[model samples]
Structures are given as C-alpha cells and as structure tokens.
Target: MTPRRGGAAGGRASRVRRAVILGVSVVLAAGALTASPASAYLPGPVDDPLRTAGVALAADAAADTGIAFGACPKDSGLAAPVQCGKVKVPVDYADPGGRRIDLLVSRLRATGPASGRQGALVFNPGGPGAPGLWFPAVGLKSAGPVTRKVWGTAARTYDLIGFDARGVGHSAPISCVRPENYIHAPSPDPRTANAAAQTRERAKARGIADGCGRRSASMLGHMTSADMARDLDVIRAALHETRLNYYGVSYGTYLGAVYATLFPRHVRRMVLDSVVNPDPQGVWYGANLSQDVAFEGRWADWRAWAARYDSVYGLGSTASRVQASFDLAMRKLAKKPAGGTVGPGELHAAAENAAYYDQRWVTFAHQLSRYLHGDDKPLVAAEAPDRSGAKAAENGDAVYLAVQCTDAAWPRDWGTWDRDNSRLALRHPFETWPNAWMNLPCATWPARAGEPVDVGAWSAELPPVLLTQSERDAATPYEGALELHRRLQGSRLVTEVGRGSHGLVSIWNACLVSRVDRYLTSGDVGDADARCAGHPVPVPSGTLGAKDANTGRYY
Candidate 1:
C-alpha cells in the first residue's frame, strides 16, 4: 500500500515518508496522535518516568520496516510513556499502488522482564468504528476492572498497543451527514409512526446514504472487515513481530477471526470477547435480527432484576408491571417529547445504552421516573450529544454506517427490509425498528458491498486461542460464540453462565477473569467449551463497582 498526500481540511494533515523503512519521521506535534506523524519503530523508553521503567524497544524488528515511533504529546492521556506512529496502507489490497490512507497507531511498552516479555498485544475495542487510540491507556491505569480483568497479566508482560482502524477516529475518518442534520432530527420509528412518519424515516436513510456518497464516495467501497484485517497485518509487520497477538471485543472478534482465517499461521495467542457469528447468512442482516430477540431477552432480565427491588424503585412489584411502566414511558414520550427534544426514538436510543450494562439500570430508571414526575432535565441531558468533542462523535457515527453498510451485502430490496423489520417489530418492538432505521442507509448505500470472510472452517494449523461470551449477551448472542467455537479448531470457549452483559471477559466475573488471565499468561485453556458461573447479578440500589458502561465495546 502506497502512502499518498491527503487533502488538507478539518484536523487532517499530510505526511511524507522515504521508501526505506528506517529514517521514517517522528515529530511530536500538537494535539492527539491523529493530528501529526511520529518517528519510525523505535525500541525502548522515550519519556515519561512512570512508564519508561523496564521498557524494551523493538528497534531490531522495526529497523527494516517503513514505520517509526516517537513520544506522544504532553496530554495524550496515556498513563505510561507511549510512542505514536502512522502507517500508510493501500485502500484496496487488490491494487496496492492505486490509493493509500494513513492508519494512526500507539504503543505502550511492556513493564515485565525483557526475557519473559511476550510480543505486542494488539487491541480493538470493537465498534468497527470506535477509536482504540486511548484503549491502551485505559489498560495501563492501576484502577478499574478493565485494567485488572481484561488486561490482566498481558498488561505487565506485553506492549499494549491500540490503533484507530480505517475510516475511524484519528485515521482518515468518514464524514457523511452534516452536524446540523443530527442536532434535533427525530430518529425514525417504523413500529409506531404514522404513514407520514414512516416516509420521513425512509427519506432519512436515503439522505444519509446520499450525504456519504457526496462527501466520501471514493473511500466508501474500501471500508470492509477484509480491508481492516489487511491493515492489521501491516501493523504487525511494522511492530517487528512475525505473528499477531490480539484481544478483540464485540465487533473486533469478527475482525480478529478474519485475520486468523487470512493468515492463520500469523496468529500466536488470541482472546475474542463477545464473539460475532461466523455464519455467512448472519453477516449483516440476520445478526441484527437476532439482536432484536437477544436484547428483548436481556430487557426481560433487567425487568426481573427491577422487580426484585420494587420496594426501592417503586416502578412495580412484578416484571410485568415494571415492563408496563417502561411501556407507559415510551407512550408518553411519543405523545409529547421530554424537553421538546427526546421523542420515543430518542428515549429508545438513550435506554439502549443501559441495556448493555446492568450498572446503568438504576441511572436510566431514575431518569425515567423523574421524567414521569414532570421533570425533563435528566432526559434532555441524556439525549444531548457530548459537545466536548462533537466532531469526534460525528466521525464515529459516520464510520459506523460506512463500515457496516459496506462490509457485507444488505438486502438491496427495500421491500425485503421493510417486511423483515415490520415482522420483527410485532414481537420485538423495543429495538426492531430503531435498529432497522439505524442501518436503513444500507438499502440505498452508494458503495457496493464486499464478500464476507468464510469464518466457519475449522483450521487445525492455527495455535490455540481463547474465546469468552456471556450466555445472555444482547449484542452478539451466545449461539454465535458456540458456533464460532465449533468452527475454529484448537480454540477454547469460556462461557459465563447466566451473565447477561455483553463483553463478558473482565467486567466483574472473577471466574472469567482468572481463566482469561491464565490463558494469556500460559497460552493454555484445557477444554473446547469451558463453562464458568459469572459474578452475582448486580443489585439496583447499592453503589456496586465493576462498572464499565463507557468502555465502548462494539455492542
């Protein structure tokens, strides 16, 4: 892949590189790692005393590649000293010399003994669109479950590295709709909307696609999982490593599986948390439909939990009554939006985040109860975007649509989409239509879709890898993880029995965390489908810790 000059606009800047891998530029410029180019691969400590201790540089491996690393800016938010770099890779692997884009990368050196140091541990926090540049920093922190459970022994032994994938944060991003379009636009709700409302929704989807084509037409077609997997290989080579060691959560599991399939021998030790389905039929459409069912089930779980503490919450004493209260809230929001902004669709979007993590259950329930009692401040605050960095948030949403729509073929027939969503909406009204509208741009997506990776084949040549999933996960259902385990030979599937949250590995399950830690440290998990009962269900009233609501796993 050739690295070409990029058009200057927004926060993007162009960087030039010599043909040779050595002598790559490393300038510590202003702002985030996304804004400037850094030095080529350098081994050892650069700055920052806290992180520089016991560091080992991969200068021997990086010397041959056209990649460099330099110290990050004063406020990169990394707990340790980290070296940041940029890699220019082909937009399309089929034509390596045709067009190119820079991929932003950051690395934190291992703090363990050099002799015992494992290679770089690559991380993807999912989202197919979430920025991972700060994830490694999260791993380095001394506090929090993510640092303890997910990172575990790997945190001490491996160089924790994170990168913003193609068309995502810090990497050349996909900017589709204008920020004004997102400000107060009511999300489409086919399940309850009138004929006129439905028409507006359909137009919104089409409008999103048209806007994407107008702004990012040339790069839209190349944002597939396959393209992303290829980028991982380039990063691995630049890291001066022969094999890839990965920890992928949510959508990142699919990305890791694709890399393993394309380059099986290059995989050393992998941990896929919350696995995506390997079935071709489920790539884009079936998987989402399945989520509707799973999310409903998870919501039921939440209702049951709420019922257990009805004396405190006062919503209801039974699951049915609690569900009724929720239904009433939605109905009220539909008739009159809270604070003149949060309609039924906005309420759904706000509550959807709560469905993924149990800790947020109290916050959401409190906010809803407050709204019903004639206060809209909390509800409006929930609906408001993070203005601290609106551009970053907008970029994430744009890349999300760009990658999901182009990764695999969505039904070209709007009739098929409409029929499926309409059918699902009958039994699964909670997320069916909202999810459909979120992805509706695919029906008229300007870019053609790519062939999905064949992930069902069981390859015996690859080394043993570990997989974890919650039995009641809402995003990537439990069945997908089982199917993935069945398809991938020499892999261990550690099941968090009865855990309803997505990204089960290190949130709060001690059994799951111990097993993952052992695997990453020793590269061994005895059984093919191991089972472990996770931590007890969180109570509604108490300030229980183990909260990871904002970690941004793909779900």
Candidate 2:
C-alpha cells in the first residue's frame, strides 16, 4: 500500500527502517581477514570463504549485449516513464553454471546528448531486501527542490538505474512464513514484561527461523552481502559500463563499500549516505545496540520538539511532560487498543517514526493528542496493522534474516542475547527490546554463517568516494561516517551538523545536495571535509491535516 503523508511509511522513514534492520546485519558477517591488494581478490575466512571465488566468477560471466527496455509492470508504482527488464544471474556465484535467477532492473535513460552521457548511475535503497525498481522515479517526482535540480542534471547526464537486488521485489523473492502465519504484533515489552513473555518471544523467533529453513533453505545460504556485491558486478557488465558510478543510502552504503572492496578498479564515482559502521566487531549485534542508544537521543529530540509546540499538541509544555503523556497513552493502549489495532506495539512503532525524521513530529504529535482525546481514526489509519502487503512484508523480513543470519555468526545461546539486551534496555528504553526481538531470529538462523568482507583492506585502491551524514542520524550514527572516512583514506566526509534525519542528499538541506551534485557532475572531492548547519527544526502549523505532512519519498 502507498503510505499516506504524516502517516505510515512517511516518505522513506518507515521503508528505510525495514531496510535498516536488514542492512545492519550486512557488515557483521565479515571475519578478521586482512585487506586485499587492488590487484588481487582476497578470500575471506573459512566460515564462508567464497567471496574471492564469487568475484572471479562474476568477472568471467559473459557480458550482456544490452538490456531491452519495455513498459514497466503495471503495479510498479513508478510515475516516471522508466523501462523495466531483467537479467539472468547465477543463484550461487561459486557454481555459476548451476541454478539461475532473474534480477529485475529499471532504467530512465539520459535526456542529454550522447557526448554528455556519463554512463549508468546505479542505486540501491538500503534494504538487504528493499526494492530499488522505483528509486529512479522517486528521484524524478519526490526529491526536494535542491535535490530536484541535481536530479534534473543527473537525468540528462546519466542513465538512472534501479534494480531489485536478488530475492527482493519481483526478483525471485523468497518468503519464510505464510502471510497469515506471520507474526506482526510487536514482541512483549522487555522493560516491563515478565520472563515468561520474553521466553515466548524467544520461541516465536525460533519458529520464524525454522519456517525460513523449511521454506527457503536453498536460498538462505546464498543471500550474503558478498553475493549481492557479485550480482552488482553482473549488473555493471550487463549495462556495458566499464566502471560503476553508484549511489547507496543506509545499508546501501555497506553494499557499495563491499562492491568497492571487491572491485576497486571498476569504481568510477560513488556516494554513501547514512554510512554504516564497517567495524567487524560491531557488525549486526553491536551495531543494533549502538542504534538503541542513538535512537534514544533522537526520541529525546522529538519530545523536545513536541514540547515546544505544546500549544498545538496539548501534550506537554516540557520534554519530561511529553514523555509522561506518551507513556500514559502506551499504558492505556495496553489495556485496550485504539481502533482495535494500535496496541502498545503498534503505537510504539508509529511513534518511532519521529526518530527518523523531524517532518513526522507534528503528525506523530497530532495522532497522539487525538488518541488521548478519544479520536482514534487518524492514528488507526496512519498506523494500522499490515494486511494488503503482508506477504511482501514477510518477503523483506525473510531476506533480512537470511542475509544477516548467515553473514556473520550470532550468539547461539539465548542467554547472551537476554543478558546483553536486558542490560541495554535499562539504559535505552526506547528501542532496545523491540529491536532485539526483531532480530532475535538470528540466534538460530538456519543457514551456515559466512565471513564479512574486510571493508578497510583495500580502501587505498578505491577512487575518491564521497560520504554524507547527519550528526544526529539515529539509523546510522555520526561515528560510523567518521569510521568509514578513516578507513577509506581518500574519501570526503560531508557532515550536516545537528540534523537527525536518517537519509540525506536531495531529501532536504540544500548544502548537502550541492556538495553531492558537484561531486556527481564534476568529480570534485574537496581538499578537506565539510560541514553544513542543519535546517531549523520544524514548527507545527497548529492545524493537523494532510497538507502539513511530508510524503515518504527520500530513501
């Protein structure tokens, strides 16, 4: 379902969260392998050592003459006149001659003259599972003014390429549990729920893991980031591009980093927004823990914003009062769900949107105030339970687990997860438990774990890459950008000081868009890192309506 403004999937916030969960698992799978030289493909650790082999296979794969453009699928939801097609790629790179699958692709050809063309600018919208078939269209119709200007120039200079990475969207998608069987309600609140409730959550996680094993055993082992990176190379060859020019957001940053590590020489120009921490020790598990802390801070930011507009929301005149109001609502919802749908779990999920973007704060406050005042219609409509796209949602979740579970080894003992998350929940009450439960299936993932690519090993061989980040980004914290900057020796870092938005570049903030546009258009990596002051915090219009809402679009 297309998300409404100020509602669920507020632009890319909701969708980006789904991708964020899965993308968090991507970096955790790398083993402690030494970096490879630019000239050689180094094999990862023995747990899943096929990375080098996969790169070799991708290199040897036959080049496609070209993709034949045709009408996109009627249900694609892309407004631009984009042509959709598919290319066959081996399901397992190590066994290139074995089973093959279709990789769905979309493209909006450059409008400029042939001499001005700079080749394909491929995009991945961050989910290890999120589909990109609609990304090019998003650039055309949804970007902010500054971004629109940049995108307009890009449309004339590059063939904007978008694709559903394998096992996503229309590209041989995989599902673990049936739609009816899938569990959508949030797990019991770890902060207040009893041990029995938590145990039940554990069992639920196991059931999901078992279901995935039973249904998609063959694909589970092959769904690692390294494998996806191989698929990217295949995409590059099919496009007939000598070097890859890429843009990746959220988890896509990790994917792009992996691609660069694997094929440094083939990279032309790259942009990584909302950078992921490539530290092997922090991969999936530690990363989520860090995310919990970061989210808590963003939640505070939301509370302060809501408090400032207390005259409109009537929730509170101070941050602490705002928290109290929100907590009281949660308590009441636990007893009786608003509209018989938004229980404690759904309410928490709805409220979490505030952590991703400031634009949603007003909508969130409006919905919360209405719920407290006995009006549940808007809240219910905005955060209703998933029904129409239950199967597709399940597919994304399935791939999320598939890649993360096998990418790196998770703690096998439930005690470790309980101990770590329980201690963390005490300090960061906002997302610790819910985030832990969302990823609990990894403790017993069915596939064999693989080693992560040593992301820093070949940084020196890479072309000058650009990194953009917000100082207060909750999804991917600012420290990750610094870590990546240090790792990629020549990469330039652009910081949006005091901003909390998850995704940047063309969503808002003209300063960031200008830097990104200059890099894309002229290959200019400034002599030093740059910082831009964040846009002012949003103020409510005092009237709650669709007009005040920002559509889910950026990521």
Candidate 3:
C-alpha cells in the first residue's frame, strides 16, 4: 500500500503524513507509532528474556505472520495465565537502532480447547495512557463467559495481542508533568472570588504548553497519529496478519480511521466505537469544543440523578438543587483550591468524571459536598480515572502529547488561547477551561510539527466495515459517528440509541452484540444503516428496581 501523505490540515496534512497508523488518547488503546523524516528508531530493552514455551495464554506463534513470540512471563491484577514480553519497535522508524525502547506486550490467549475461530482480536481502550498491556488477560475474562467459549474455538482460529504504545507502561516512560505539579486545595469562595486565580490558571496553562517546548520539545515534532499508524503495521507484519482486525474506542476510532484510510484492504471485521471525528480542524480545537459540550450533557445527567439520593447528599431534593450545590462548590473551589493545588481545573476534572458513568455519580456528589463544607479526602481522590497497572496511561500521555504536538501547530500566542478559552468558557464553564489546559501543551510543542494525514475516508477499495456508536457518548459524540460514517464508502453504521461510553459492543444489547458477532464471523454487513434503536440502557439500580420504576428514571 502506498504510504498516503498528509499536510497542513488533516486533508492537506494527508499529503505529507505517511499513512501507516492513526491516533487517540481514549478507550483501551490509543496512538500508533510511525516513522519520521529524521532517522530515530531506537530499539528498546528486552525484559524477562523471551523463552519459547507452550502455554494456554501466550501464543508461541502468530497465526497470520508465523512470527515466533517468546513469552515474557509476568502477572497483573487479574490472575489469568499471564505472559509478558517486549516487541522491539523503532523509536524513530527512520533509525531502527539509534535508541531502542521495548514495547510491553501482554496476552490472555483464548480459553478452552481451540476449534477453528478467527484470529486474535486486538483490543485498545484508548486513554493513550490506559494499560493495554494487561487488557488481553482481562479482556478474555471480562469479555464475559460466552466471548471466551467462542474465542476458545476461535483461539484455534485467533490469538490475543496487547501492547503498550511508546512512553507508556513498561515502555521507557516520559513523565512530563509530575503529580507535584498538580494543585489540590479546596475552594473557599463558593463564588469564584479569586480574580488572582483565574489569571494564574491562564498563565499556568501557557506555561504547561511552553514546558513541552523544553522537555519533549523534539518529541513534539514527531508525535502524530500518522506516525503511530506506521508502527502498527510493523506489529501486523510481526503478527503475520495479511490484514488487521482492530477494535478501537474514542481516540481509537481516529486510529482505526487512519489505518483503514492507509491500509483499507488490510482491514478485517473492524469496530470503531464512540467514534472520533477525523477532521483535522476538529483534531486541533474544534474537538475540545465538542468535548466541553459532551461533558456538559453528562454533568446535566448526573445532576438529575443526584436527586434520588437527596437525603444522603443533602444537596437537594431535585437535580437542579444538586447542580446548584455543585456549582457553589466550584465557586468555592475557585476561591481556594483543594490543598491549594487542585484548582478550577481539578474541580471540573471531577465534574468530567461524573459525566463518565452512573456508577461514579454518588462519589462525585459526596466528594464535592465534602470539599465545600470542609474535608479533603473526597476532594483529593476526585474524578481521576484509576490507572494502576504498568502506569500505561501515564506513559501514553507522554507519548500522546509528544505526537499530537508534532502533528500540528497549536496557537502559541497566549492571546489566542485566552480568547478561545474565554469564549468557550462562557457557554461551557463546566469542563471548558480544564479541557483547554489539558491540551494547552500542544501550542508550544518543541518539535517541528508535521502535517496531519488527510484520512482517506472515501475508500471504495476497502472492504465493508462495521461502525458502532452510542447516542449520548460525551467523548466522541454522536455527531462524529455520523461524520465518520459519511467518510467510509462501504461502511455500515449500526447505531445504539441513547448509549454512553465507547465501544458498547459485547457489553450488552443482543441486538448490537449480535451484529458484531455476525459481521466478524461471517463477512456479511447487513443492509445500510442497520440499527439497535431505543436500546435498553444499563441501570446501576439492578433489573428489578429498574422494572418497578414508573419508568422515566435511569439508573
């Protein structure tokens, strides 16, 4: 396949960027490594020397490539027969051995005896930082019981591959911002009375952006989804797949999009969920605007649900009251941050978490109340996503920042950032500024930013692929789902109405799961625009109480 080039915009950027991989900082797996103009492929450390052994979990030989893999034995949280090892990839594809960095690979091969099933399903949870190294083991267990049974026969059919992208997990880490850099004080004003803080936040946001120029400055020039896409192909070549069948969520959708665009013919039974819009403009700032809007919807949803626990929260009898109390807490936080470190950014960080799922709402409300009235535990342990294993997400963040900055030029002029934040915050004060701060580093990235790859969506040469999406997803937003569908020629979009989170497949809704199963097992992607409408949303309150409700209520 010709390596498609990208340029200034994802369209124009497409002309300059080598079409090998895609990018993202979400779901299970995000970001693919690629080659650059400068030769910089450094090999990585080979941990736990690979030993050839036959085990139930790790495969000795890849199905398609016939590449031999030596199991690097290790263990993670889930006690599955665990195998850990390293895949030596180019640090800079241009220079294969300048500085080697081992990419941590893990696996939880198919359970049960093998019948002939399709090959391994590579699962990426996004987060660019999420620990995918451990997911293969967890996926086999968590795909629930049935996926296992199918995969068991399918194991004879396929194998499982989990990899940590550059600077993530077991890979050489790049910790740009230390935990000490984070502010964690409680808010005292309850009205955002600190004018000093707003200015400080802006300055810090700018500083963080500039810091990238110092620390990962050279890295900034090379980190792009396009680069990572190339790295995946090396892996595919190693795995020996004639084509790759991938499952990506949130940012992974972007990864999958770039891959399908670059190697359309190599795609087999792909799933892009809670899709990311492949638009380059959206890639820079427009995407965050969507995030602010998406999180706002989630915030509203959380507020409404808090009403049920009014007695426990004492925040309100209705969701509105709860929202007010939360807003008051933010105002208070703005005045005096938790431990004086966590600021408006931190407050909104927790708010964004509430937007993630219902299981987390009570904790968000309880913690917000504690911070408001006078407590620090809940506030300190706020809405942050748990990233315990291998510190994969942390490493991914380093790599994510490096590549995203290298891919494009963010507004380096502080005024532009200020102006943009001011405008977005006016409407989306919830997570707007924090989201801005999260991506601010892109502005002053040190590396000479390259062009973005024009994701070639209209690929008639590509085989039909399946795309799944949830209605109220905050990360990717439903609009992106439609836009992506518009790009892929032979693509089939299967909608799961009113769903949240990324990659809702195999989670539930037989209607949705079955489509994925049929599509993967048999190369049939039913008629255009197939849908599992009005899907029954999963409620935390259990099926019985859910059934008893007058019915407008959601868990």
Top candidate, metric TM-score: 2
- Ten contiguous residues with the weakest lDDT in model 3: 48-57
Worst 10 residues of 2 by lDDT: 31-40
1 against 2, candidate with superior TM-score: 2
Better of 2 and 3 by lDDT: 2
Per-residue lDDT of candidate 3, residues 1-555 (tens digit): 012223533453332122211111111131112322111121111101110011000111122223344555444454445566565554454423223455666656655456644666666666655556655654454554644433333333446677766665565556565534433333222113146755665566556656555555434443567545655555555565556767777677777777677556557767787788777677656777788788777677777766765655567888778878877776665776666566655676666665865445556666776676677666676533343422344355566666566655677776887777777777666677667666776765555676555665436757887888877778778888888888888788888776564456434456776676677667678887776764443243431123212123442
Model 1 TM-score relative to the real fold? 0.84
- List lDDT for all candidates, in order: 0.71, 0.77, 0.57
Q: How accurate is candidate 2 locally (lDDT)?
A: 0.77
Ranking by TM-score: 2, 1, 3
Candidate 2 C-alpha lDDT tens digits along 1-555: 011234542544445445434422442344212222221233323213333444444443425235666888888876547888777777766445446788888998887799988999999888678888986774565555545665776777899999998889899888889978775553234345357878788898999999988888767788888788878877887777767899999989988988887777678899999999877777878888899999999999999888888888888999999999989888888888777777777778777877987767777888999888889888888887778888778888988888778778889998898889888888798988888888999988878887777786667778899999999998898899998898887999999998788888445566877788788889988998999888666556654732332333221
TM-score-best of 1 and 3:
1
Clashes of 3: 82
Residue 372, candidate 3: alpha-carbon lDDT: 62
lDDT, residue 204, model 3: 60
Q: TM-score per candidate, in order?
A: 0.84, 0.88, 0.75
Lowest lDDT sum, 10 consecutive residues, model 1, at: 49-58
